[model samples]
Target: MASIQDEIKQTRPFPSPSAEAVVALMRTADMVRRSVASVVEPAGITPQQYNVLRILRGAGEAGLPTLEIAERMIEETPGITRLLDRLESKGLVTRVRCDKDRRRVWCRITTQGLELLRQLDAPLQKADEAALQALGNHDLEQLIELLDKARDVYRRIS
Candidate 1:
């Protein structure tokens, strides 16, 4: 079977994709996610679920609401509710209605939830280590710097 690079091959010179950066970022994110997801899913949680828990844990006792958690999230918001639901069912988190606003619901990472996250610390670290193992220290730092600059450029533009 012919590869995409081969399929796009031409005898004559052609304009290269300005979209290569976008493709690289996306593919890198996908690879990183797949590696992490395999480790996370076995513990009965998705990548996003782990993200929310981590954020809540970082926030400590003050905690955060569903919306706040959603806002801080790197992914979509609607998914947070579902992720919270699963975590709640697993006895990892707790949901409580606010006193000032009866209609509003708030989420707090329970002790159990924090412990579960603690349990994943080593494995997640390992996942990151394994993902970047191929790249040398200096190259990895350079790659991270480049990605951060890319985000900053987008922020300045829009």
Candidate 2:
């Protein structure tokens, strides 16, 4: 297997291990995202849309406020209104104004949306498993711990 430096065809060594690790993390993330996209593309929904659906599913029958959905997203997405609009147009989600709080809009996944997610559940699991198959169980756990620690560093500094 080619190392990250070789894969990127960088002739010179990275300035530091931190820089190299950052580049490797980014490249690996993008590769995994692309793999996930390939799986979801056939279902006619982008990965972002699928993310919203799953979030709504977790929210249950009461649903969640628009802002709450945005907060719960795995990545910060600009123009959430547009994303919601697309999902609404596809009839996968419903947006309703909160009766008590007129300013807030509550979003819920439809039965169709639930069914779509159900269909995707197995395939998504398979894709995730395949993406991490190179790592043994212990290595995967350690990687998760290290990644979480790395993210926490930013959180603490910020």
Candidate 3:
């Protein structure tokens, strides 16, 4: 019988032969995303939405500007208006026009949002555990370090 690697096609041949690492990250991130999303989606929020709320929770009840929140996100979203729109519509989050500057909008996670996030906590933990269960602690740490290093590869280019 073929080994496990023989049955899967995760990486195609790369001209430079070094693109395998990129392929692995893409595949692993994709798998983790799906697994994580499954756990969080039932809470009525996408990963991005949850992330925004989490950031707000950490930053305190005062909230953060939309552009600032976008800067802190893992991936670049299409600005923050639509995201806030969806979250607000769900009553999970709220947007307030800054009194000092009418053009500045700050986003605050509502009590409902916090409650939903609280409900999602245990399940999210389980989902993360399930996703990383195959790896040993040392291996997981190494993988995390590698991904972080890769992310910082071209600070100037990005």
Candidate 4:
């Protein structure tokens, strides 16, 4: 495995280990994201769109409010409305105003969205597995734990 410094072609030493770790984590995340995108994009939806569809599918027939979907997203996006608009235009989702609360809009995955997700499911799983295949289960578990701990600290400070 190439060290982060070598991969990034950094001749000078990092000022701190934390900075190095942060960069490494970011680089790895981008790599994995691209890998996932390769499997998803050809199906006509970006990864973010796929994420929204997955969330709505999990929400079941009742669906959820638009704000709730935003809160549940893996990557915080400021243009969720635009994201929904694109999906809606593609016939993958539908949004309707709440009867009781006129201001609240509920979003749901359509049959097409669910079908797309179903088609991608196995391929996405395979892509994810391949991305982490170099790591054993124990290493993956430890990595997850460390990431969770780091995120917990971030949440507390943020």
Candidate 5:
């Protein structure tokens, strides 16, 4: 397998180690995301939809407000309204107005959505394992720690 530099066919060296690491991280992330998409696409849902379903499942019967769901998503999704619209049309989710606060809408996963998630549980596990297989258990743990630290630094800066 080619290194990220070789894969990208870059002739010049990166200006700094930080630049190279950033590019490599982004490329690796993109590849992993595409791999995940392949597993999800067959189920007739995008990865973002799968994420929403999983979040709703975690919320249980009480569900969660739409904005709360947006806040909990793995990535910041600006098109949440459109995403929810698609899920609602597919019968995967329902939007209900909060009783006490008529202005707030709660999003709940439908039976079909929960069933879909149950069906995906195994495949998603397999996909995640396969995606990270190159990294042994120790390496994976270390990578997680390093990534967490990087995120902490980002949070502090922001």
Candidate 6:
């Protein structure tokens, strides 16, 4: 394993342990994102689109409101409307205005979206597994717990 300093070719050390950890986390996240993008982008959709499709698929027949979908995204994105527009144009999803709440829009995964996710399912799983292949089961669990603990700072503020 390469040190963060070596991987980034940093001549100067991070000022603090927190700074080093933050940089390392961001770097690792970018690597994982690229790995996922390799799988999903070749299929014609970015990872974010894949995320939205999966969220809607999990919502089932009743579906979920547009805002709710945004809340559920793995990566927080401000342009969810544009994301939906792209997915809608691709014929992968549909949006219907709620009858009772004129301002609320319900989004649902189309049959095509479901089918696309189905095709990518196995490959996505493999990609995810390969990303963490270096970690044993116990280490993986500890990493998850540590990540959760790290996020407690944001949770407290929010």
Best by TM-score: 4
Model 1 has a clash total of 0
Error of 2 at 46 (Å): 0.5
Candidate 5 C-alpha lDDT tens digits along 1-158: 76986756676678678999999999999988998899998999999999999999999998998889999999999889899999999999999998999989999999999999999999999999999999999999999999999899898886
Put down candidate 6 lDDT per residue, 55-146, tens digits, no spaces: 99999998899989999998898999999999999999999999999999999999999999999999999999999999999999999999
Instruction: Tell me which of candidates 1 and 3 scores higher on lDDT.
Output: 1
lDDT of each: 0.86, 0.92, 0.85, 0.94, 0.93, 0.95
Best by lDDT: 6
Q: Which of the two, 1 or 5, has more TM-score? A: 5
lDDT tens readout by residue for model 2, 1-158: 65986757576778679999999999999989998998888999999999999999999998998888888888898768889999999999999999999999999999999999999999999999899899999999999999999988897886
What is the per-residue lDDT of model 1 for residues 1-158, given as tens digits with 9 covering 90 to 100?
A: 66766756653244455566677778988999999999999998889899999999988887788888998987767877788888899998888989998877778899988988999999999999999899999999999898788779887986
Model 5 bad stretches (over 4 Å): 1-11
For TM-score, candidate 3 versus 5, the one ahead is 5
In model 1, what are the clashing residue pairs, if there are any? none
Lowest lDDT 10-residue stretch of candidate 4:
5-14
Ranking 1 against 6 by TM-score, winner:
6
Which candidate, 2 or 4, would have the higher lDDT against the true structure? Answer: 4
TM-score of each predicted structure versus truth: 0.82, 0.91, 0.87, 0.92, 0.91, 0.91
Rate residue 143 of model 6 by lDDT: 95
Output the lDDT of residue 148, model 4.
97
Better of 1 and 2 by TM-score: 2
